[model samples]
Target: MTIKNIIISGASRGIGFELAKQLCAENHQVIALSRNITPLQALALPNLHPICFDLQDQDAYKGLVAYLTEKQLSVDVLINNAGKIINKPFEDLGLQDWQEVYATNVFGVAELTKSVLPFMNKEGHVVTVSSMGGVQGSMKFPGLAAYSSSKGAVITLTELLAEEYKETGPAFNVLALGAVQTEMLNEAFPGYKAPVSAAEMASYIKHFAMTGQQFYNGKLLQVANTTP
Candidate 1:
């Protein structure tokens, strides 16, 4: 496979870190973005460029767009993996909690995507990481109403974007991922053991990230063997 220029959000750790490692191993140029890029810098891959920025910061997202534009770089794949979770029951959750979750999961993804659209290759692929909880009829957990709702919003946003960009622009899709072993998961559910590992999820994400534009668009992929 020809090397592709890929941009991955939340690349400091977890699934994002693995995605950067595996994609760089495949000789792809990876632009890794995260609030803390120190971990990414430690990777020391020649093809990996680490950008430190909070996805919730609109100015930072715009700065990234400026950098890409100045370099005349077009991305083959864009992975929206940065997300925030507020694990509080529906009754206990406040407006701030909801805003915090949506800020990172939905608003950030949308703003960055809008800025990056011009830098996407004609056949570029856009993959947004969502949660299985966001998928209707899937398993629901207590204290995840805010998190689930944010992810669900992104899923809808992604599909709408896919339709808007269907004939021209890039292809867009959503991965309503199942329980994956990651820091976020542990934070959301203490002592919970997930069937899928972060590395495994990253591998699957790479597969779809690389092939989504070529095969499917506007589809919500359920990346779980069984409902959690």
Candidate 2:
């Protein structure tokens, strides 16, 4: 396996945190981004660098890009794991609620990735973590209308990126994950037991983030035993 410098968004907890932990254990440089990085800072891993700021903050985004440029950092893998889910019925979902979800889930990912592209290695991979509900024909659950719509947008965004970068260097792909046990999942489906654990999902994401582009480019992979 090849180990290289990687950047992970939304890494203060859950799948993102686990990914940072595992990757840092392997001696890869992991730049973990989150709105609150106190939990990450508590880990105290030398290889784990935590940056605290909302992805929607343009100043924070520019600061990150500047830091990378000043340090001459070349990201080998960029994982867009940061996301926000709004669980409200379609009618109850206000415009602000939808905007908040899309702001972090879609626009944030796009802005961060765009800023990093100039600093990414030619053979690097850009992986976005989406949801199974975003997939076409997937079973739809009520109250997740906004969340699902944002993820669906991400899938299409990733597909278009794959095509746009086909003849280019860095490969783009999206992982449509099924129900995974995490704080977010628990909040989304209160008391429901998800088939996959956060650790399991993190391990799979680590593998794909490290090597999926070798076998796939512009692909939407489903990482769950059950779909929808």
Candidate 3:
């Protein structure tokens, strides 16, 4: 059997859900998390272990750790895919909006990661799903201040963690995902188009992850609108 244990957050739908479903199909045991506790009937993968909790909830981590420890789960991969974006003009973006965005996308992720790291075995991989907007100048649409900034912070956090963990830290990368068909985008840009489908992106991410290329560490895997 393969080293199948992985934890995927933000997995109720979109790229997170697709990645979890596809990984399970490839015989990986996926521990999926989202605000909603139930698994989507459409993603009928037997290897999926579902957990429902709002990442912002401090109480959730203890229960999660207790459950995993009871099961004697040692993780091979830690996927920080859970995040929220509020695409609004900086001026128009209220403090509450930014707080909400950071609470889920940044602070919560860091908390979960910190809580889970001890359970990750050596050589385990950590993948953080980020955004191209976090990269260099992009003349993209408006109302992206909160989302883009938070993603940039996530990338920085990934790099810092990579350095801190050194050999013990799993090879980590912040994948800067291009436009993908997701509910988040649909809500923000109603008539907007995406460069790829979530399933396709998931496939590419899984493949990129398996390569285990050292050069990719502490760098951005720029998966464009193309094959990625």
Candidate 4:
């Protein structure tokens, strides 16, 4: 059967917005979420539904499960595409720094997955967007300590779900991608060097989200052009 309903986080802009736009173009119902009270005008597609809510809000997801439950929203796919990276030295990373990253990157994804699990079909797919730093530890970068660690946590979480969901596991995978041209990078670093178009990454991610691998859960697939 053709999967129809897809729920994506971080759909305000960047890869998330692009993916939502493309998927909706293909006629899939997309429930887009982000940490903003303001609606995302970027997703003007016919099948896109935007929810303006911040991940840091304590009661943001309180009634989410119940709402999905009441609506019987059968999610064919869940894309955990939300995250942030703070560039700074390890010592410079403070408590608020860690909280900020985890709140959006780790905690939000984990909570949203939990909220949507009951509504997700057994054969559905769960795709999390991780970074190349998650795979290699990114020791070369000065400001990626917290960012890299958060991604590592995401990877670890994906592995656990892969093992636990063996029988009825949602087909899962982590896209360890390279640079993508988006507001995320520019916002994090006003003068960063790594450059890649977000549109390309969105195209790749949208394709994979539709094609679920039966045995590739917890595996990290790198997508950097620098590699020959």
Candidate 5:
């Protein structure tokens, strides 16, 4: 198999961490980005490169581009898996709360994708991770007004990007995930048991991120067995 240079965000734990570990085990060069990369560094895998990255930081994007340029790495897959959520009732949600969520979920995804496009291989894939709550008429909860709406925005963004870049080469797709037993899930829904584990979901995402572009572009696949 041809080794691919893959970039994944939110790699400190959960699905992102599993993706980094699994991809490196397969001999792929993995660039794992997260605010706290200590967990990733502990793995000490030669093929795994952990970088301290904050999705909300503008300076971090520049640093990432510089690092990629310095390493002369051409990205084959870019996974926008980093997300932020504030679980507050709509009436209690302040402007800052909404901004914080969108900064990471929507704006960060857009900025990071744009920053990495020049380094992407013509046949590369960009996968943005969304939530089932974002899909219109799926299932609405009380405390996800900001989080869910931001996710919906990215779905449209991905479609627009795929259309614009269709003639260029690289492809864009978004995945609306179902409930997974992740730290984020535990935080959002305390004491709730999810049918899927983080590693299990990560495995599916790993396979999809590497090969899904061959058959899908500008498509939103709802990877959920249960609703939130």
Candidate 6:
């Protein structure tokens, strides 16, 4: 397999952590970004580069760009996997709750994508991870008013990005995931068991991030077997 420079967000745990580990193990140049980098740093893989990054911080984008420039690494794949979810009833949800979720899930995605576009070319792929609850007509969950809506926003953002960059190059797509046995899942739904494990889902996402652009662009692929 060809080694490519890949960047992924939310790499401290769950699917994101697994994805970063898998890619680095494959000898790919993987830059794993998360607010907490200790987990990734502990791995000490030569190919894995961990950066402390908070998606909600606008200034962090400049640091990322500087690092890429200093390393002279042009990104081949960018996986916007960082997300925030709030499980609160619609009536009980406050404006701050909505802002916090959207800040990470939506605004952060858009900003990061924009920041990395210069490092990508026609061959580059941008994969934004969404949720099944975000899909139109999908079964709706009561406590995810803010979470689901924030996720939905990224789906549209991905489509618009794909269109705008269609002629220039780097393809964009969004993956609307189903229930996965992740810490996030446990937080969202206590005592629910998801059929998919983080490593399993990470493996699938790794494959897609590397090759899915060949067949898909401006598309929303549902990657779930069951809803939570």
- The lDDT values for all models are 0.90, 0.91, 0.81, 0.79, 0.93, 0.93
Better of 1 and 3 by lDDT: 1
lDDT, candidate 4, equals 0.79
TM-score of candidate 6 relative to the true fold: 0.98
Q: Taking the tens digit of each residue's C-alpha lDDT, what string does model 6 give over 1-228? A: 899999999999999999999999899999999999999999999999999998888889999999999988899999999988788889999989988999999999999999999999999999999999899989998899999998899999999999999999799999999888888889888999988999999999999999999999999999988644
Which stretches in model 5 have alpha-carbon errors above 4 Å? Answer: none
Give each model's clash number: 0, 0, 1, 3, 0, 0
- Model 2, 71-157: lDDT tens per residue? 889999999999898777789989899889999999998999899998875589999999988999999889998999899999999
**Could you tell me the TM-score of candidate 1?**
0.97
Q: What is the C-alpha RMSD of each candidate to the true structure, in Å?
A: 1.0, 1.0, 2.2, 2.1, 1.0, 1.1
Estimate the TM-score of every prediction. Answer: 0.97, 0.97, 0.92, 0.91, 0.98, 0.98
List pairs with backbone clashes in candidate 4.
Answer: 35-54, 88-143, 181-196
* Residue lDDT tens for model 1, 91-140: 99999998899889999899888878888866899999998989988888
Model 4 lDDT per residue over 118-168, tens place? 776667889999887777644345688888888888888888887788687
For residue 138, model 5's alpha carbon misses the true position, in angstroms, by 0.6
Clashing pairs in 2: none
Candidate 3 residues 1-228, lDDT tens each?
A: 465688888988888888887888789888898887465445666788888768888888887898889998888788888878776777898889989999987897788888788888666778888888887665455788888888889989988988888777677788988888998889988988897988998888876665654456777777785532
Residue pairs clashing in model 6 are none
For residue 102, what is the lDDT in candidate 1? 88
